[model samples]
Target: MFKQKYGTTALVAGASEGMGAAYAHALASRGMNLVLIARRKEELEATAADIATRYGVKVLPVVCDLAAPDATQQIIHVIGDTAIDFLVYNAALSFIGPYLSTGPSTHLDIAAVNVQTPLALLHYFGGKMVARRRGGIVMMASLAGFQGSGFLATYGASKAFDRVLAEGLWYEWKPFGVDVIACCAGATATPNYNNTHPRKGSFLEPKAQLPAQVVEECLQKIGTVPSFVSGTGNKLVSFLLSHVLPRKKTVKIMGDSMHKIYGSKWESN
Candidate 1:
């Protein structure tokens, strides 16, 4: 049923490893050919080869930096006429510190990766889907997007943009037979998240989810809702942060969590 609806081929950005790789494997398990994009050549090709061997589906690995201005064009060139029935934008760039700590260049790169590329891809592939009258899109948003996160301010803002964009597109494209969803994921045990080396025994540490679990929930809920928080705990937390608490309190709570995890001077990409 999953494959029949959004099968044949899928394109996943930032698919070299972690949650992106999980998304690739899940789609391939459903018998979909894959076009995997990421910046790491060795990792991307290795992931593609492994998926092809394990699932017996065509896997094309394209090593392209999502922050590059011509990233969407590069992907389109590699994909040629392959109609991507499902598109997943999972690539992101984050600087985990005070916003002003990073220079303008770093913030610009984050905007490029987290915002520009996804919007460009959506416009290109989504237009094709609308014409064909069938397809799906998954934009990887974050729980941080629900409000102003202290340390991860820029990244959270970009994700908020994605969440709202996906919801609006969901409504606009529903009648055209295209499904758009923003997977508002919580803290998952991805390589990047682990690299941050978050301190033990924090309020949210124990609640951290695995990559496979997050991707599984995302796939299951894509066509069902315009946007959804991946984990049950995340869902509850999202509600409390967005609906139950006052804005200042919610922001303070998130800020304190970040302080606990990364302290004042740490950074991670």
Candidate 2:
């Protein structure tokens, strides 16, 4: 029961892999043509070909880092003259480990990928959507966004900004029949886990969620809510963390764990 059923066209960032790939497939299954953006050109092309073959949706690939200055304009150009009714701004980068230990430039780059690009996408496409008065957007956020972290401070903080921004926009746009969803997904298995957490295993190998679970959720509920935490387990963790744990304690525990796992990777696991 997607509130905004896929009809005309859709734009998705980070559409080459993980949840973004799942989202592109779901939208294609709903009969929407897609313009997909990702840093990897070959991967984007491959995904487009697969989707085109299987779902028959016209898939356009825009290879971009998105953290670059020209990214917004480049995307706008690709979307020229297309009536985009759905936009999934799901591309994000997470650099785990201590904030102070990481280089300032690296943190800035993380901000560029996680916060800046999405902001640009919203500004560029949101204006057009509002003018048309018919579009829906999902800004892929994480449960990590809900609170501060010790090891993953920058990533969590940026996602916090994303979640709030999406919620604020959702309220302002829904009356215009536009839905801005802030999806807070928990630890669903994706390649990016290495970037987000201090782990050393494939997200697949039966540990975390398959990409399909997140995609399935996004497809079923397009615009009914401002936010949707992806899995029940994730939802529960967020709930407990929100209600049970004190801020200082949580930060301490997270920091210690990170120190054990990532900050000292040379040490035996």
Candidate 3:
């Protein structure tokens, strides 16, 4: 029952599935009207229907790819004339290959959605939240974003960008009564894993609370914590790497792992 102190309106991007859909439902359960965004119209519709039926809360589904060229403007258009109490930027993408193996354009595109889009989201609605003087904005980042991962070079880097920006915003917006948090999630059972290496220790089987639990916890915590790392293992790793490992060593280890996973793909690129 620990929702944001702000009024009851929550907007979640990437709500077609996984963490996004879960966040939508969590807010709905707390009596917040919902605005869900994602590229798949049918999937968004299905998610909206379930939340409406299960929680008896209003749900609005907008189909737009955050990675699209005009994603920010499109998202802004959808929020017109509506006040949002909470904003969860939960969209994500991953390209698995070494730095050279991946095309530069593809890597930059990852930045467009993962890094630029989040900043743009902040640029658009952030002021409204600050002016109203209430609300929360959560950025969905991964522990991998904490450091460079060789095969997932662009993805890891983008996450790095997200984490840094989230923390910076928390400080900048705190005076305005707006809270920002970056959730550093560990590996979860999401469809993004299909492109990954099977034997890599990176995979964490879905269990217990699942992605839904993480989403729910995030909503419940809002202003209580400015930054958080989900999952014990992931948090443990984050702590250890910061205290025990050197950056050079960590990057090398991750790079070697990427090489192992990508094989000749890294060399070809």
Assess every candidate by TM-score: 0.96, 0.90, 0.89
lDDT of 2 at 45: 96
Question: Cα deviation in Å at residue 133, candidate 2?
Answer: 1.6
What local lDDT does model 2 show for residue 242?
Answer: 76
For 1-269, candidate 1 gives per-residue lDDT tens digits of 88788659999999999999999999999999999999999999999999999999999999999999999999999889999999999999998888888799999999999999999999999999999899999999998899998889999999999999999999999998899999999888999988878775245433789999989888888878999988888888888778999999989988888887787446443
In terms of TM-score, the best-performing candidate is 1
267: Cα error in model 1, Å: 10
| For model 3, the run of ten residues with the poorest summed lDDT | 200-209
**What are the lDDT scores of the predictions, listed in order?**
0.91, 0.79, 0.79
lDDT of 3 by residue, 1-269 (tens): 43548678888988888888878877888889999989899989999999999998888888888887789889778778888878999998777764675567887778888988878888777888999988889999877787777677788878888888888889999999898998888766655544353445433322223787688667666677778888666666777666789988777666775566566654675
lDDT measured at residue 250 in model 1 versus the true structure, 0 to 100: 88
Most lDDT-accurate candidate: 1
